[model samples]
Target: MRAMAYESYGGSDVLKEMRLPLPKVAPGEVLVKVECAGVNPVDWKIMAGGLDALMDVVHPVVPGWDVAGTVVRLGIDVPEFAEGDEVMAYARKDYVHGGTFAEYVSVPVRALARKPASLGWEQAAGLPLAGLTAYQLLTRLDTGPTDTVLVHGAAGGVGSLGVQIARSLGARVIGTASPHNHERLRGMGCEPVEYGDGLTERVRALAPDGVSVVADFVGGVLDVTLAVLRDGGRHASIADHSVLGSGGQWMWVRPSAADLTELARLADTGALTVPVLRTFPLHELPEAFELSRSGGAAGKIVVRP
Candidate 1:
């Protein structure tokens, strides 16, 4: 199989295309022919050795977590899916290696879900990671119609999905972004506020009594969260671990077939949208990594095999 892998940690420059053997499927896994692979900021972050302390790294690592594809074969004792099933998964494992940025990948059944019929291959590939992150964060906070939720970094990949999920649950959403992204956010049912200086004042103007929930996708804004959050309000951060010290929970997204299924249902029902900004062929992963690092765009990036 043809795939991209990095023998050692560095930057996008370390990624190289090569021929590798197909992965051996474990008892609870399935082999998938990769149609598309979703690229997240974490892909580049892992490539740069940013997660060295948290997860063990194996050499010749293929860096990707989100995939949308078809099942070619099932492993022993598997009964949930058939050989021809269309699927998508947040394919994170116990260690870093054997990922979705290849012609094929082996995914555990626990992380796999059927693709939403309403989405294209690229859009479905974009769903597992960012969509699951937003869904898990908001649902854990128990946001509902009676709550006013504030989302930081609302124009980016995860933030945008969060806005839609919160809206689907009947919550009024206030999101932080620049002037250029405000109109687009409004289309997603989010009231947009400019970030940076005076962010607290702007959010307070929208919810003077303080928002009932605050979700921080972008880090370093604890002051704003503390300022605009109501007393005993819910708060969580994916980017800021220091939030643990300030009465807010810090979370990492887990792979769950159930949660991913719910997100797919939302997509099929027209209640959620996966915004894919651009895509690159398998060999052009370095360019995709650079694009994600620059933050020049505000939607998900995907790679085609």
Candidate 2:
């Protein structure tokens, strides 16, 4: 199989396309022929040797976590899926050979879920990591029809899905984005706020009592997020680790097949949208990585295998 792997952690340049042996499945796992892989901040972060202390190193590491593929074979005792099932997943974080940036990956059955029928491989590929993170954040808020939720970075991957999820739960959503995305945010049922000077005041003007809940995707904006929240309202941040000093929780998204099922439903129903800003073929993975780091890409960057 052809894969992009790095013998040592360095930068995107270390990611090279080569022919490597296909992964072997263990009990409770399945082998998937990957169609598309979704790239995230973690992909580049790990590539840059940023996670050296936290991760155990093995040479020739493949760095993607999000995969959309079809099952080609199942491991011993795995019964939930059979060969030829189309599935999508956020593969477990530490599987060295299960990285999605290849023609095939072997992942645990626990991490897999059927891909939504309405979406193609690229859109299905985009769902797992970002979608699950957005779902968990909104779920933590316990939002309801009576609540008004504020989401930061409304135009980005997780934030874009979150804006719609919050609205789908019957809550009014107020989202922060650049001026250019305000109309886009509005289309997703968000009251758009520009994330700059007077951001707190702007949100306050909209929800005078204060926002019922605040979920920040862009870190370093804690002061502004807390200021706009109603007294004792819930606040969550997924970005930086800076303490907000408000008894709020710092969130890290975990992999969950159950959560992906719900997100898939939303996409199938036309209540959610996954935008692919661009797609790169397997050989051009480095170019995709460069664009991903440069910022201001319109939507999720996908890699086709």
Which candidate number has the best TM-score?
A: 1
RMSD of 2: 1.2
Q: What are the lDDT figures for the candidates, one per model?
A: 0.95, 0.87
Tell me the TM-score of each prediction against the true structure.
Answer: 0.99, 0.97
Which regions in candidate 2 have their CA more than 4 angstroms from the true location? 95-97
With candidate 1 superimposed using the best TM-score fit, by how many Å does residue 109's alpha carbon deviate from the native? Answer: 0.2
* Tens-digit lDDT string for candidate 2 (154-221): 89988998998998889999999999999988889899999999999999999999988888888888
Query: Residue 122: error of model 2 in Å?
Result: 0.6
Cα error, residue 291 of model 1, in Å, equals 0.6
Residue 151's lDDT within candidate 1 is 99
Q: In angstroms, give how far residue 283 of model 1 lies from its true place.
A: 0.5
lDDT of 1: 0.95
Cα miss at 174, model 1 (Å)? Answer: 0.3
